[model samples]
Target: MTITAVWPISSEQDPNAGDSMTITDPGEIETLVSRLSESTAGAATVWHEGRELADTDTQMHDHDVMALVAEGYGYLSYIDADHDYAVLDGDPASPAWNGEDVDFPKGSGVSPETLAEALREFLDSGERPESVEWQPAEW
Candidate 1:
C-alpha cells in the first residue's frame, strides 16, 4: 500500500485544506519533518491506500496529527484500523491544529526525531507506527 502525507499550504485560507505528497522513500520523511518543525502552522495527515489515518468521526479528525508545533517538540497520534494512539513522552501540550490550539494529554509530546521515526514506520508499514510507546488518546 502506498502512503501519502498531506499538509496545509500556508498560503491557503483554511488550515485544514492543502495538498499531498506520496512518500515513495524514507529520505522524504526529513522533508515532511522539516516542514512541520519549521512552521507553527505545520501539520500533516498520513494516509494509506487513499484512506486517511484518522478517526471515523469527521468532527475529531482534524486533531489527528504528526506535527512539530514547538521547537524540538511535537506530538504523534492517529486512529488506524486497530486503535487510536498518541505517543507517550513529555507533559501535556497544546499544539496548533486546523488553525486552533488543541490540547494533547501528558506524555503526548515527542521530539522531532521521534516524530520522524514514527513517520518512517508508518510509511514502511502503512499502519499505525510500532516504533514508539503509545497510550490510548485521552480525548
Candidate 2:
C-alpha cells in the first residue's frame, strides 16, 4: 500500500512545518530511514489516507506513526487502532521530535535497521507494527 511520509525540512523550525513524500514501494522506506538515521534532527510521520493510523478524539491533529533517529538510535510510536493506545519505544530516551527534545516513555533503544523494518511493516500492513515492543506514553 502507498503512504505519505511527512518530515521537517529544517530541524530549527516547527516540526509540523515541513515537506512530504509519497512512498509507493517498500524500498523507499529504507531510504527514508537512512535519512533520519544520519541526522539527530531527522524525524518523520507516515500517514495513510491523509489520516494517522491511530484514532484521536480531539479535533487537533495528532500523529499516529512517528519515528525519530539520533545518535545511532531510533524511536518509534503509533496509536493502536483497536484503542487509544500509545505505542512507544521499549527503552527510555529523549529524542528530537519535530524541533525539540522530548522525553519519550521507557523502552529499549532501537537500531536503524529495526526502525526501517518497522516502517516497512507499517507501510505494508497499515496497522500497528509488530516488530517493536510497545509501551504507554508517559506524557
Whose lDDT is greatest here? 2
In lDDT terms, how accurate is model 2? Answer: 0.64
TM-score of 1: 0.67
Off by over 4 Å in 1: 10-19, 50-66, 90-102
Over the stretch 4-97, how does candidate 1's per-residue lDDT look in tens digits?
A: 6666666656665566677778888888777666553455666655444255665333224444445457677675446765545554553433
Model 1 / residue 62 / CA error / Å: 15
lDDT of 2 at 89: 52
Q: Which 10-residue span in candidate 2 carries the lowest summed lDDT?
A: 94-103
> Native-vs-model 1 lDDT?
0.61
lDDT string for model 2 (7-75, tens) is 665555565556567787889988787776654344676676544533366543344666777666777
Q: Evaluated with TM-score, which candidate comes out highest?
A: 2
